[model samples]
Target: MGKPPLSGIRVVEFAGIGPGPFAGMMLADHGAEVIRIDRTRPGGLSLAIDAKDPLLRSRRSVSLDLKNPDAIAAVRRIVRDADAIIEGFRPGVMERLGLGPDVLLGDNPRLVYGRMTGWGQTGPRAHEPGHDINYVALSGVLHALGRAGEKPTPPINLAGDFGGGAMFLAFGMLAALLHAQRTGEGQVVDAAMTEGSSVLMSMMWGFRAMGRWRDERGTNLLDTAAHFYDTYETSDGKYVSLGAIEPQFYAEFRRVAGLDDAKWDRQMDQGGWPALKDELTALFRTRSRDEWVALFEGHDICFAPVLGFDEARADPHNVARGAFVEAGGVSQPAPAPRYSVSDTVVPQMAGARDDAGLLRELGFGDAEIAALGH
Candidate 1:
């Protein structure tokens, strides 16, 4: 394994679902030693269709019930030397489990305690059971998706779950870690998916304030208001994306599609979007997604194929950049945002280390190990 950027930073993950594991994965990607504290039971919820569960990448897992006295003591020992710890659970679940930050942070003042949840740490919906779609729904992002006059389609949990949820938690934890390293003081990060999802829509909020964004869902420029900034299907049932947002790009797009001058000049004026979209749709239908991909490969036309996970992994750009790495016969996204001179190893899948290894990595010694034996 190549040395990763987060090589020496040890992270403990109290696994929950969705964003929690994903945040852990991000830390692992950055080269942190992330050990997931998992229960023996896979529990009630599981979404393991992608074999290795892409979100579960870049971490080691350990199965233990913290209810046990020995296990609880073991965790305290781990936290005492740990840099950061993240958990996704209801407000009092961790405290009920006897591993709350109040107790843990006191054990080590330098620990960055990150807590992630659906609604937030404090709210009417804090105790409610909801998922990404629910958070997006409440945050108004879900309503902004899909075509005009249609039911609000969920954007596959990107806004709430990962974008708002995992990404935000990871960001907060890392930010706090940096501060802790410099000041030798630890703090708690309360990350709420609803808040994060709403933060992700700041640009849209700005557009709304400027009266450029419409609330009618998918009726605005970026949300299918413009004919050029949308997706079109091909003869082969595949699809390609279009983003000819600029005048020059739209002109080039029309030129490529054999559009005449009069129709081409009607960019973003009047109700010409429907006509333009219909024309482009008809033109795109003439070829498969691949054909158009080749047609617009190097153009500023802002074109791209709507490739699926497998196709995405196989695409030349993804392949060339090593976007997906294969491990344990499963393909998953590689660690992101490459650095010039950092260790770059894909964290081994699942529990690739023993308890002793995890303990020592967190600064446990033989005496501490013997203490756990009691």
Candidate 2:
């Protein structure tokens, strides 16, 4: 790929699960030179692993024990030239390693320090350990999901982890990088998953405050409470999602579904949602998912089949848009945003580029390279 947007950017990533690795991958995907510091035991290969985590791709890995003073010092040295340093751990982990943002920025005044935690850097729960589900639950996003009477369904790790942690961390780092570019000064971005998840609810919060949305589960317009917007099971035991909001779109949806005057008249009425959902479900079940898809294919009803990961890779629309690409015999979704002049890449392999090659390109001397000896 000819020079990506982040081609000249340098990032140092402290190895972490889910969100941290994902953030690193995003930066690397855009052509940032990302170096992942792994503390895992050396020498391991696994056939069970997916290799297409959508997280570990497009980066270089250096195994180092952060507990080691030399290793900590080495990390600082790496950050000395980095545009940004991102770490995801409980509150004190990096500070305990002696490579905290305060110390690193003291050394590299132009460095942007990005921190990701489940809670935050200074909240009462900051030092506590929690995962994506907990953060989302606390933020009320989880409760907003699922059927009206059903328990909240975890949307995997997407909401709190990727949406909150990785996305926010990437945004923070990039914003800080821009600031550093203009002023030659750096700043630290404290990105808490809780904070990000709350930010995600901004529109909902406004709705609730204005009495336009409800707190009850699955009752709000966006929460699948409306007949015009929700998922319905299909004949093949799979499903299809409908989001035919707005008067005209819902009118098209009504016409497509053969809705009568009663259904059309009270489309947005709170009292009619259950009847509407039942009617839609019955109509949807009469035909296969593909049949329904074909029926609504060209309309602006915001219709989509609820395709799984494998199905998505082979979908015609996705294929046409080049949304998924195969690399190293593995197929996964590609990096986003079609640039007019720049290239966006999917990292074909995790830890593929040589560490030695990256170091040399970054201007590391032989002695400096040698000092990172295992």
Against the true structure, whose TM-score is highest? 2
* CA lDDT of every candidate: 0.82, 0.82
For all candidates, the clash counts are 3, 0
Candidate 2: where are CA atoms >4 Å away?
Answer: 40-52, 351-372
TM-score versus the correct structure, for each prediction: 0.91, 0.92
Give lDDT tens digits, candidate 1, residues 187-300: 999999999999999999999999888789868898876888999999999999989988899888877777776966878783888877888789889998888888887778
Task: Give, for candidate 1, the lowest lDDT window spanning 10 residues.
Answer: 42-51
Model 2 lowest lDDT segment of ten = 41-50
Residue 10 accuracy (lDDT) in model 2: 88
State how far residue 87 of model 1 sits from its true place (Å): 0.5
In model 1, the runs with Cα more than 4 Å from the true position are 41-51, 351-374
lDDT of 2 by residue, 1-374 (tens): 46799998989988778888888888888889888877735432211223656677877677665656766777787889888988888888888889877899999999999898889889678778899999999888888878788999988989999998899989989999999999999998898888898899899999999999888888888888888888899988889998888888888887877776775688778898888788778888999999988999888788999999889998988999999888767787788767888897666676343555766765667786676553
Candidate 1, number of clashes = 3
